[model samples]
Target: MLGAFVDGELPASARETLEARLADDPRAAARVAAWRAQKAALRALCEGARVSGEDAAPDAGQAGAEPAVLILRPSGSWWWRAGMAAAWVAVGAGLAVAATMLVPRLAPGLAPELMAGAAPTAARSETSEAFARRADIAYAVYSPEQRHPVEVGAADEAHLVAWLSRRLGKPLSVPSLAEYGYTLVGGRLLPGNTGPAAQFMYENDAGERLTLYVASSAVDRDPVRLLRDGNRRTFYWSTERTGYALSGPQTEPKLREIALDVCGALGGKPGQW
Candidate 1:
């Protein structure tokens, strides 16, 4: 019933009754909120990808340039929207796997260089940079949502962790940032460079949001690195198991501190350099 309300599929009379119930039932209200947030997150991800693809395509008027083709046939059909969403999920999974495969070929000397204490450089594989940039973009797109910032609220921490863990095929945990005055708002599953990714969001009392993006990667060990795109700052690193990127509009020092907390919570000890 709440799902139908969230999707706008409820009949007029049914919708009114649902709204009346939601007005009184806190649990139902929370479920409705989660559903709405999930829907908005999906729309944001799809639109961001669509806009990015369009921006990258060559102009149709350019000599020998082929026109970009985007299928916009979903219109208002729920089935078509669902199918398109599934297709996008598959595309993301495939891209992530392809990137994982290319990491070795693109940077054959990466492991040795890292072992020699060299940092990732301009010569690093495009896949690493893409993953970080995508994390930044996802943060920018979803963090500012007023009504629906997270697909699941922190109250459902166990289920959120379990669901994302299953999707990513790895054990997952959410770190506590209470020491920094930010509590977990919740998390959602996203597309990663080689497979499924998970994003956990935290919010401070001031309403500031920070996101931690976790994904599986071929590159196992990398130094803690800071990346800045526009006003956002990200501290990203990788372990033998997975890669992590924490992004927000916080100061460098603050983000670094939080990153260390995250690392400690995740069973790592990243040196401050």
Candidate 2:
């Protein structure tokens, strides 16, 4: 009995039964307590405080969620490992049952055409937030690094447009940023969690860089939305043909100014693109 418990070979139902029996049997309780203490001490020595109960609880009632399961593999000599295999199999079966009851929700729905999956509108909001966070990360990645700033620099105006147009599936042109004291730095193809996108970068003589990430709507979207978040500003709008997003650390007024110029230079329809 002591050996099975030490090896954690008892099934959960059997363990529960033994636990109750131990409460009534002082000798069994003493042995279990000693074993637990030794296990805790070993774990503490190996993993430090991180193995402590500091894990935050996951959110409830989310679809496509899966609970985490820990598997303990047999690690002794071949004979010992063979002896433990059956015990681990029982534990694995128990975990499979528990997982059916406690599946985790998917990561906030950043997939293309989620409406086809019939997800709720609320879930869509979470997806948008996730994208915004990703946009910030994209900005951070390209904002630095002077040498490899853009894939196609401003000097190759014709080439930049041709490449971006082929990648974005749209006719793209480098909007004149001279008025804003910025020139085209280059452009690149960025993959979003939901779909593919195109990012066109620009730079001013002061060396400030701005970027535009363009992708078509992954879901049915509103006509136009302008979001200014802290140092990052986003101008997002969906037309019949495509969706456009201009994001940067510029102010709302400045972002709008650049966006209008981009639209005009692209020959995009007036009002919004």
**TM-score to true structure, per model:** 0.55, 0.51
The global Cα lDDT (0 to 1) of model 2 is: 0.65
Residues 202-252, model 1: lDDT tens digits: 999999999999998667676678889988998887776688889999999
Name the runs in model 1 displaced over 4 angstroms: 1-126
lDDT of each: 0.81, 0.65
Tell me the number of clashing residue pairs for each predicted model. Answer: 2, 4
The alpha-carbon root-mean-square deviation between model 2 and the true structure, to one decimal in Å, is 19.9
Error of 1 at 257 (Å): 1.1
Score residue 227 of candidate 1 by CA lDDT: 86
